[model samples]
Every structure is written in structure tokens, then in C-alpha cells.
Target: MFTYVMRFLFCLLTILPLSLYAAVGDHFYYADWYYEILSETDMTVANLGARSASTPGLVYPTVEHNNKVYTVIELRKESFSSSYTFKNVDFTNYAPSSYKIKKIGDDVFNGTAIDPNTIPPCIEEIGARNFADRNDITSVTLPSQLRILGSSCFQSCANLQSVKGNFHLKKIGDGAFFMCQKLKTVELSYSVEDIGNDAFVSCSALESLIMPSAKTLGTGAFQDCPKLTSISLPSNLVSIGESAFLYCTGLKSIVIPENVISIGKRAFEHCDKAEYILFKPATEPAYVNWKGEAANFTDCFNADIESKMYVPSRKTYEHGIEMISFEDKPLTYTGLSPEISWKNNTPWPITVDTSNLPKTAGEHNVTLTAAFQNPSISLNIPYTFNIVKAPLKVTVNNSERVYGSFDQNYSCSFEGFVNGESESTVKLDLSYVTEANYQSPVGTYPISATLTPANYEPEVISGTITITKAQSTLEIQNLDELSNLKTGEGVIICWISNAPHSELSLGSETTASVELQKMSTLTNGEEAIQYRLIPINPGEGKVGLYASGSHNHEDAYTEFEVKIEDKAGITNVHTDCVSLITRPYEAIIIGKADNAKARLYDINGRLIHNGIDNVIRVAKRGVYILIVNNSRYEVAL
Candidate 1:
């Protein structure tokens, strides 16, 4: 038992050191060991094989024994890894003098040398013509200061899922990211100015893109991106290169801006899924070069992808005006034509038909027909012409006299005025009189008339006629008893006659006046005349009347004596005082009566007040009068 124990102890001692040495050496092959054992494990390590160790979450270079480098090969942490390795060396501290690459996670990488000076002499950009076929990277966050992405950068990176941090980038070189089948999202910066030829071509997983600041697009810029459903081109873009958007089948519609002057060959060809192409040029008759050929257009529109051309109509001549009169010349219209086309080819010649035009002077509508050689292709256009008319002139003959007791007839004449001169006489009709009344008493009457002329509307006119009464005898009676009149008093002289008088003349032999108070014809055909005789001064006067008729009726004359007296004790005077009856509130004295000492009394004969200065003011409403110098003057209020 003792001999077997000694042999087993010796063999165990030798194999234990060898196993520890092999375990330590496995960390030296960090990349191989990581893929073999810890590729799927979740852990963090700062320094794997270096002289000095780094902090737990910070990655930096540290020299250790033997001047060797180490990094984390595959860290499957929840947030981010601190350090990583490529080919078993740490490249987190690499500068432009010594360019290197390192993978920090499953498909994530970091690079330190990003500017142009850090790149090789033959390469114009940091990643130009490099890494075209790399398929392992799933996401890349580039440096913030990267200005340009060179030709074919990251092209054919089939597994590249996303790219971030291109904030200061200015241009994207030719074929950059071309055929990156798995690339899903890439946000370009606003500082970017141009997109080079074939950029982003065949990026089938890219759904939406925005290039807000780019002004020019090179040839085939977005060709063959079938999964690209939407793209926002810059508003200030000026031109598009050949085949720029070929085979972009996912686009629904597009509007070409007016600022873009040229579009290259096949730029929008094979875009079969696009429903419309809205080409908005700046002006009419725009010239567009398509497929190396030029075409003129007034407006470019395609509703459903079927090509249709619009050709504007041209006016040949202006329409003439026609005069309105019986002796006017016949009117003829000519020279109305329009250019017509279909599918960019002229198919017909236009002809205007004015045969159905009316002979009247007014606006007339004419029909224009685009009659082609083929009857199936025809269109109609409606046109118009203007016609004028001369004004009408009317004159009526005045009658010397017309008896009011008999019916009468009259007429008016009309003429057409041309160049301020009468051309021909126009016929007038009596039935066109709108208003005519001649049965009234003798007076002047107006006649309202309107007439219609050929090819014109109704014309209005005005006329007048004088009417006179028939011959009749005029006589006055019952005025011989108007003799006793008082000073400042009025007497009414009345008379009856068998004929109505149009006027009457009155005269006085003394300083007295007479005024006609009322004159009216009674219902029995007899006339009544009344005159108010005012005895202004105390004297005897004669009031005469001369009645005259409207026509040839004989006039009659009559006279009466008016003795105006100033009686000192005249009582029970009538209420016909001229000044007192006219102005009932004021008191007035007769001729040569001064310092009269008047007294006022109401209609009931009751004394109310006294007056001075031969003037009285009655304060209440009633019939009152004044008695001056024992003479009573009655006033009716």
C-alpha cells in the first residue's frame, strides 16, 4: 500500500502544473478561446493580456510583461463592452499613424482614425473602396467629424443593419453603400451636399430616406431600391442624372420641382408602380429633353400614365360690330380657327360655322368644329361676336288748341340717328302710348309713350298737349246788396252763374280792396263765385266783377257800392273784421281810432280783460272780440 501511494502522488504532481500552464496560455490566444468558450456568455473584462490592468468599465492600452496586447474578444454584456480584440490584439487606442480595426461586440465595431489625413495616400477617403464585401458588421457608429464617404464604402455589406453618426459629412462618393442588402436605416446629416453615382443602389431593406440639404444627384443614385417606399428629395435640387431612379417600383407618386432644369435619359424609366409624374415647369411652352430628344409643352400632365398632349387654341381675328337700321349693310364674320391635337400629333383642322347667325344687332354665339380626316376625332368650340345699334330719335307736333268737351287725336314721328344725323323716317304707332288722359278740365296734359324698333329694345318718349273749354255764356247775379261795410271789416259778395268761369277780375272806385274767397262748380252744373270786400279806409267804393271763360265763352260784368263808415256807437257788429278775424289773438283798431280804451269779451258776452296800444292778446281758446270807442269788433277763434 505504501509503494502504490508514492507512485500516484508523483504522477499527480506532474500533471497538475501542466494543466495550470495550459489554462494560463489559453488567455494568450484570446480570440480563439473567446469563440470557442465565451462567445455566448454575458460577462465584462477590462484587461485580458497586458502588463497593467484597466478599470472594470473603461477601455485603455496598458503595457504588461513581454510587450504584448490583449482585449476582450466576445463580450455579451447587457449594455456595452469595455474593450474588444481583433486577431488577439486591442485596437481601442489606435491612431492615424497606425490604423487598425477591432470588433467590440457581436456585430459592433469602433475606429479611432476617421479624418482624411488618417487615411492612406492612394485612398481619397477614410473607407473608400474598402470593406466592400464585409458581411459580419450588423451596426456601425462612425466618427462625428467624418466629412466624406469614398466610392464603394461599405458596399455589399449584406449583414449591415444600421449606421449612425454622420453629423458633419458633406458628400457621399460613387457606389457608397451600394448593394447593402441588409441595411435598414441610415440618417444622413444636413451638411451633406451631394449624393454620388449609384449611391444606395439595391438597398432592398431600406424603407425611407431623407436628404434635406443635398442639391445634386449623380447617375443611378437610387436605382433598384425596390423596398424603398418613400424618399424625400431636397427642395433646392437643380438636376437629376441619367437612370437616377430606375426600377424604383415601390414609389407611388413624384412631383418634379420647377427649379430642376434637366432630367437625364431613363431617369424615371421602369418606375411602373408610380401612378403619376407631376412635372411642374416654371412657364408655359416649356421644353423638356427626354431620352435625348426635346419636346415643347404648354402644360405637362399625366393622369394615369397614358400620354396626352394639350395644344392651346389660337385666335385669328377680332369680330366686327354691326349697325342697327333698315338701310344697314349685311354683317359677315370670318377668320376663326384653333389648333387641335391628340397624343402630341395634329389630327384635325378647325372650321367656324356662322351660317345660323341672326340678322339682329346684338351678341351672337357661333360654333367652331375641329373636323379631322377621320370622323371619329372631332371637337367643338363655341365662339362669340359683338353687334351694335344706332339710337332712336322722336319728335311730336304741338297742337294750337283742343276743346276739352270733344275727343281729339294726335301723333308723333320717329327717326334713326347715325353720326349725329337723321338717316330715315321711322313709323310711329298710336297703340304704343303707355298713358293718355284728355277728359280732365281744361289744362295742359302729358302723354307717356314707348315704341319698339327692329333689332332694338323699347324706346321711351314724352309729349304734351294743351286743352281748352267749349264756348259758353258766363253771368253773375246776387251781388247788388253788398253796400253797407264798416271800416277794417270784410263783406262777402256772392253770385251764382250757369257756366264755370276760369278767371275773374275785380276793381274798386275808392281805397278799398276785394279778394276772391271761393269759386267752385256745383253738382247741378251751376257755378258759384264769392268775393271778400275789405274796407281798408272809410269811404264809398264800387266792387266790380268781370268773369272770363277758358275758350270763346262771353264774359259778364257787375258792380256794387260799398259805404265804409266809422260809427261811434256801432254795436252788434258781425265777426267779419278783417285783421281781428285773420289774427284772432291780436287786437286791431279801425281807421283814425287812437287812445281807444278797448275791452275784451268772450263769446258768452262776459267781460274778461282790457287792452292798450290798440293791441290785445287772448290767452285762452274761444270766440272773443274787443270794443274800442264804443264800436264792437267780433272775432271768431
Candidate 2:
């Protein structure tokens, strides 16, 4: 009840003074009444050696004998000299005597309450806009009782470096100390929640800043001050306004807490020197809509660092292996003269799993990471492991294509490449084991290619070889089925064409059987016909066609279906069986026997392919399959 009554009486007193002034037809003039008195008063008239006389009723109207100025009138014309006496305003008996006096201008007083020696007749407040536009004032000491520094109180005080005191301040008004250029270091006290736009802008020399209690950096607050280097932002700070640090170039690195949602454009513009902005790892997978994958910010930012040279340690000439992984076996290094320093940030002697590398032969690149106290200089040492085991290489010499026919012959070979400087060799060991429903070149074949340089490890430096039995196709042709002919009268059953190292032993009729021969007209698709006959006998009851065209261990075989027909079937075979005249294009059989030796010939009796064929390119247009020696196949081209 007492508190409410006191507050009511205080409100009435404030309204009564304002009402009385308004009713008297006077505009409410908010000015320093004490300042006006201090400005124009003569405190000591008796001590003056009067060079300039104060004319009565001219300079000021002295009323009531106290020398108080109720109004000002035009001064009577009098010449004033430099030696005229000046009076200092005396406030010896004032209510607040020991206020923390902050001198803003030559005679302007922007002060806060001091330890009062006496009780005040009225509530004393900081004068309205009292400290306005005082750029010359760099240092200030506020009173503990200071409640407010009104709007624009310290606006545009560019040199104002330090502001101290004022424990009770609740708000700092708008545009307060807008461009305090020399004001680099600021100690913001409690309860300052809101700072207006353009506050504390253009303080270029600011090097270090710590905003422990700041809630936000207002719009354009620190724009265009290029010399700022580091800032310690509060984790609880919510938002930093647009263009807040737009042109601050000396800053090197920064971290944006997850709490900050948006960073305005041009807010970090022209800040090219800054490298690697750290951010909290995303809890949810953050996908890049443009890249269609989870963004590897580390890789992307590192690439940017490399291209722009923003990070001092990202220079291109710096040599370092990136990352190496061990799989299947611990990677072994040979002839490493300088002791290899196990790198990466992991605890020393950490064993990484290496059970995924190819058991046979291949090349792989691995990566690892290490932490260093000095990141800039540590990049010169690789954070990855590099080792070159005996490089394993597998080569299919024309490894892409091969084929064979029943009662035919074929050949196949293998080769390899070395991936490092190791002197290991891979020797081929063959075995004759038939499985998987077919007879194949089965063996525990071990092959490898060792690097010759003994220490250098190239990325793709190994090659190897494996020879296997070729797959064969089936073709049956006879002259008796097409033309009316007798089997006893010599009906040329041209079977064997150019079976590399194959043979056929006639089964029951070895005396009168199909022979191995070369037909001349069948080579180039020429209509005119000729034949080169090579006598052959089907040995025993089965005509076994064996192929030995491949490497020494890659020989194979295929059996042809036997046909026993009457004499009338032989003449019909000429007309219906093999249409040599109608076969489109010509067939050229260019193939290798043992030791990779081969030959090529056209239907026009021309050698197009050599024994050691370096480059063989076949263009099969409208080519018929050439059933050569009832074994291999040559497409008519």
C-alpha cells in the first residue's frame, strides 16, 4: 500500500509540472537549464578588473538580486578585448557533488551520478542527448548509478576506444557511437541485449575480439574494417546480421556453430584469405542436391584450398602420399633407405585390418589420416602408408576372344605386367584336370610381375598371364547331302583346312576317309574354285581331331560326328551340302601355333598377316564362318 501511494504521488508530480507548462502556452523545451546558467553567468563580479562592463538589462536581466537570468536581451554595443575577465560556474552546494565527470567537448559535461553527499530535491537523470557526437572523447568513466545514455548519446564518437563503468545501464540507444574507428577494444557489460544498426562500424585496426555476452552482431555493425584478424564468438550468439563483417580480410579461419542457420551473402565477401571454416558434423546425412550424394566437405574444401591457395599448407609442390590402406596382408616395402615413419593421427603401432586385397594379382590405392600439432608444416610428411608387394599382373594376349571346333586345333597364351620396383617373378605351373563338365587347363598357376627399380612403387605397375583351353563351335558339312554322288567314287570331303598342330585318325575307314586340304577359291570370296589336297586318314574307329595351336601346355581337341552314306548321297552333297560358290566374302585364317608363331593369307594368294603378328585388326563384314580343318574358325572378311 505504501509503495503504490508513493508511485501515485510521483506520477502526479511529473504530470503537474508538464500540465502547468502546457497551460501557460509555452512549448515544452527540453534543454539543460543548469548548462545555460553555467554558460552565460558571471559568478565573481567583485574580482573583475572591469575591461568590459556588463550593461544592465542588455546581456541578461538580473532579477531578484540573486543574479539569475530570467530572459536574454540584445547586449548594448561594447568592444570586448582578449584580457576580459571570465567567470567559472560554481556548484559547491549542488545536490550531487561528486559525479563521475566525463568531459566531452571543451565545456560540455556528460556526467553520471557521483557518491552524493546530500539527498537530491528531485530525481537527477542523464541529460537528453548530452554526450551527442563527441568524437574526440576516446575514454569514458561512467558512474555506478547511470541508468541510461539516451538515443544518440555517444553517436559518431570515432576515437572513443574504451567505455567503462555504468553497472545499472539497461539499454544503449540507437546509433550510439556509430563509427568509433579507433575504438577497437570493447568490454560490454551486463544487460546490453540489443545493439542498433551501424553500431561500432569501421574500427579497422581491431585485431582480437571477444564477445562473451553479446546476443547478435547488428546489421553493417563491423563493415569495411579490413584489419580485423580474429574474433571469439559466443556459442550462444543467435544471429549475425548482413554485411556485419563484409570486408574484413585479415581473418584466417572461423567456425560456425550449428545454431546459426543462415550466413548472409556478401557477409564474408572479399574475405578470400580465410581458409577452412569449421562446422559441426551434421547429425542427419546432409546431401548435396547438386552433386546427388553426401557432401564430403573435407574433400571439397581441400580442393578449393588447393585451387585457390588459400591454405598455406595446400601448395601443389608439396610432396606427400595421401592415404594408404592395408588389405589381405600387411604391405611390405623393400630397400627403403630412410626409415619409414609410421604416419597418421592414430595411436602408435595401430594395426589396421588388411584382409580385402585381391588374393591373385591387382593394383589398389589406399588412404589414411594423421593428426599433427602444426598442420601447416606437417603436410610435407605423408599421412598415408605406401608399400609395393610383388606386383600381380594378369594379361590375356588377345585375351578378349577365342574359339574352336570339334576335330579342330587351337592355341592360347598368357602375359603379365610389373607394378613396382620389386624383383619378384611369377612362374606358370600347369596341370591337366578336367572339371565343371568340360576339360580345361586346370592347375595351381602362380604368376607375378615384380618392379625392377627395387623401391619405386607406381600406381599401375603389375601384369600377369593365364593360358586356358579355348571354347569350340560345331559345323557339319558334306557334298553327298546336296548332290547325287557315290561314296566309293572319290567325293572330295574337304575337312581339315589349317588345323595348327591338330591331327585326325579315321576310325573304321581309315583307308578311304576325309582328308585335310586347302581350297584356293574359298579364301577371298572369289567365284572361281581351286583346291590344294593334303591326304589324311581317320585313324582307328574314331576320327579324333586334336588341336595344339596354343602355347606348349594349351593344346586341345574336338571330335566330329561320323556320317556313313550310300553312293547316291555323295552326288547330292555336291549340290546341297557345301555351297562353296555361294559363300559370301573370303576367309583368312591367321593364327598362332606353339611359341606364338602365326601366318595370314588371303583368297587371292596374298600374305596379309605375318608369323609374329604385331597388330591384327579384323573387319568381319558379310563373312561366312570358315570351318578350317574341322577345328578352328576364320571369318570371311
Candidate 3:
């Protein structure tokens, strides 16, 4: 009773609150864009600012949402430069007037409560510090369409372990993952072109990096990263920023890309353990931010650390080219070396990248890098090649069509795509054709399934379509002859038709005078079925045969009369033709009766089915007579 009373009061309080003054719409700009719009579609939301209630409101007097009206409150104006405090309005359900959010503006999420975990695939850009200082977040898998990460977007995400899925990302803003101490791995998309200043600074746990398309490294981009054992730079890299690897002590060796034009001051200042440095370019690049004249090469590394350059006799170059078959596995560098230097006392190790190779057949380029622990040699090799598409298998599934059907209901399936691709990745033009038509006779016809392939060789696996004769007509041989049935006399009404609708049915009038018994299917398969009907009373009635049809067919029905006279036929006769039973699958015939010569005939006096042992079975409906010992007997089998 108390709970019900409280619930009633609560409902009353809720209803009266709608008239209260409240704010709505973009009152505080809590989100960079409306959360509902950002998470709902492939549309871009831009210029989303962090939530702020610092600016006083004086415009609205009313707001409507979900068909309920609320009075808006007015507040005194405040200075634009006034210090702001975090205060969010209940505008989660509010939609901005426009949905064209295209780019995340700078400093938009500096102090907001929004979580960046649900960034939709349609979102292409992220503003700086959007998720900075948010230690609660553990992982971030960016959308495939995201093109850029704003400066410090996820900086100080202490729990972040992996950052991936940004297949189209081109740039990483300054300090994007700065101080993210736990970040272990970074999977740079092949399209990434630049890494900004301090982008991954102080990411102490980072271990691996493979940037295949990167062109530049900004100042302090990877400063203080001690766990990065190796870095894969692309052939397109043009510059290395200052303090880039200042304290990357774990890097035992480094490779200067052949295209690098400049190296900032102290680029590898504290990389004391570095023993090898190889310059791939034939000419020395301008050592910007260094002393007036050319200092020792070790100046790029620790002052005490020795770094040597090797002149090339055995230079790195592209291998002989071959068009890759789509069916062939991704190419590996296990046996191929871009550079071999026997002059160096220590063995030079070459890294053949078999992993991250493109899976789909197409024209692609890869960077071949070789580095050594001593002499500090760096070599960058760029190789371009083509992958020829393999033959694709298209099978037109086997089908069955009605002999005269006009239904061009054809279907096909496709087989064979690479691990990273599917049929949807290619333009498929599938067409199916057969020589058979509606007037064609019943038989099998060949069907060809063809496709135009752009990335794959077209290999068609032909199929067949079988034209089956339709079961349009029903026949009961002696149906009209079943009008008269004696009291003890029974007839086996064989239900014959290609279409199996239902068992033989008796009309109300006939059903009242006769007892219908179920029987087995004859040797002719489903086309022949038998039913035994013995009259129990004298009356006139009707029997009906009905069938429902499928496509290109029509329903069928027929009616016949039946008359039963209340009199037994040879009920006292001690001789019978056969002791019969009706099992659905097969017939069970006992030994013949009386050991006499016997023959059976239809009502038209035609001979019954020809079988051994003088046995008679039902295959068609008719009046049957048994001539045994030249004596006559009538019964149903």
C-alpha cells in the first residue's frame, strides 16, 4: 500500500515538471557534434566544441522535445573571456539544426565528459586532445574512414594497449599518443604519410613499428621510447626531425632511408648502444642544425658512439620482376636479399618483409630495408610489382524446371577470393542462359554462368537445368464402374496421379454407408495407391478426387457416384483367391486359396495385371472378378 502511494506521487511530480523552465538544444555544446547524429550515419559532423555553460543564455522562452513543452530559463550575460567551468546541459536528445558535421575543430574536446570509444565509421577527423588525460579508456580501434588524428587526441591514455583499424588515416597530429606509457603496438595504415611532433613521445612500452608509406618524422616524434627494438621506415621518407630518437636506447641499429634530405639536431643524440649506421643514398644529405662544418658522423648519434658509412659495391636494388598469380601466396623475402656486404667484419642482416603484404591481386609497392648493429648502415629499397588475378570459379547451380514453365528462375554461386577480399570487392556481372524454353521437351539442358572479372580471371563452371514433365492430369482407370458395391463386395480404388494431394475421400452420403480402409502403394511407385471400401449399409453417395497444383499448374477435381446394396456376396463361400494385406511400401501376399487355377479381370472383362503364382493385386480402380476352379468370386485386394 505504501509503495503504490509513493509511485502515484512520483507520477504526479513528473507530470508537473514539464512546465518548469529549462534549457534545450545546443545550450552548452557538450559534444563535438550531436552524439545521436555522429553515431547514426555515414554523414560527417564538424566543429563540435567541448561542453560549456560559461556563456549566459537570454534567447529562448520555450523548447519542445518528444512532444512535451518546457519553459526556457534566461540568464544574465557573462564576458566571453570569463573563465569557464564544466557544466553540461541535458541536451543529449537535442539535435542540432544542421547535420553536416565534417571536421572536428581544434580544442573541441578539451574538457568534456564525452567518451570517444564509439566514434562511428563516418567520422573522418578527430580534434586535438579529444580524449587526452582520459586514463580510464583502455583501447582505441579507429574507424576505417578516419583520415587524421588531431594533436594529443588520445594523449596520456595510460591504459591504451593497441591503436588500430585506421586504414585510411594519413596523418598523426603532434603528441597524438604522448605519455601513453602502456601503448604496446602501433599499426600504421599503408596510407599514412606523416607523423607529427611529439606524436608518440614517452610511449615507454611501444615495441614495434612498420610505416610503409610514411614520408616524414616530426621533432621528438618518438623521443624517450626505450622499448622500440626496430623501426621500419619507408623509401619515401624525406626528413628526420630533431630528438626523434633521443633516448631510444633499445634501438641497436638504424637505417637512414635513401630519400632523406635532412636530419634535425640530436636526431639520435642518446642512442649510445647504436653500433651500425648505413647511409643508402650515394650522396650525403644536408646535416641541418649541426656545427658550421661537417662534424663527425657520430654527431648524429651519441658523441662517444661510433657510426660508420659504407661505400657500396654490393648495393641494394630491386629484384627481377614477375607478375604474381592471384592464386599464389603473398611474396616473402626469406630467400631474397636487397643488399649483401661481405666487406663488413660483422654479418649484415636483411629484413625481408613477408608479413603485411597485400593479399588482393593488384599493383603494389613495398620498402625493402636492411640494417646492421655495427658500422651503423641504413639501406632503403623500393620495389614495385603487379599481382595478376587468378582464375575465378563460378558455378551455376543445377536446377529443375517444369517442362512448360516460363519461370526463368535461375541462380548461381561464386567461389574463390583471397583472404582479405570477397566477391563484393569486385564488379560482378553474372548472367545465366539456357537453350531450353517453355516449348522444349522434357530433358536436361546446359546453362552457362558467365562474369566479367576485373581483378580475377574468369573461370566458369557450367551447370544443367532439367525440364521435368508436369503432373497436370489425374486418371482413375475404372472410376465410373464403381457405382455399384455389394454389401460384402469391396473394390481397390487405385489413386493414380503425378500430384499427391490427399487420400481418396468419400462424400457424407457414401461415408455413412461404407467403411474405407487404407492400403499400400503398388509396384508403380506413388502413381499407384489402393483403398478398399466395403459397404455397411444400402445408400447412394459420391466419392471425390481432388488435387492442388503448384506454379504453372491448376487445381483438379472429379466426382463419381456409388451405390451400395445391403446384401452379402457369397458370404458362405469357403474358397477365396488370395489372403491379402495392405502395407504402404510393398505387398504381402499369402499362399493362394483352394489350390485351384485362378485368373482375375477388370470390370470391362480385360485381364488383370500379369504376375506369377496366379496372385492378383490392385493397380487401378475397377470391378474385379476372380475365376477360381472355374468358379467365380468377387473381393477387394
lDDT of each: 0.44, 0.35, 0.53
Better of 1 and 3 by TM-score: 3
Please name the candidate that would achieve the greatest TM-score relative to the true structure: 3
Ranking under TM-score, best-scoring first?
A: 3, 1, 2
Distance from true location, Cα of 88 in model 3, Å? 6.8
Pairwise lDDT winner, candidates 1 and 2: 1
Total clashing pairs for each candidate: 2, 70, 13
lDDT of 3 by residue, 111-132 (tens): 5555565434455777677679
Model 2: per-residue Cα lDDT at residue 346: 21
lDDT of 1: 0.44
What is the TM-score of each predicted model, taking all chains together?
0.31, 0.30, 0.39
lDDT string, candidate 2, 415-514, tens digits: 2233332223433332222111212121223232322332232232222223333432222223122223212211112223242433333322112223
Report the Cα lDDT for residue 597, model 1.
33
Candidate 2 ranges with C-alpha deviation above 4 Å: 1-130, 142-151, 165-173, 280-637
Off by over 4 Å in 1: 1-91, 94-125, 280-637
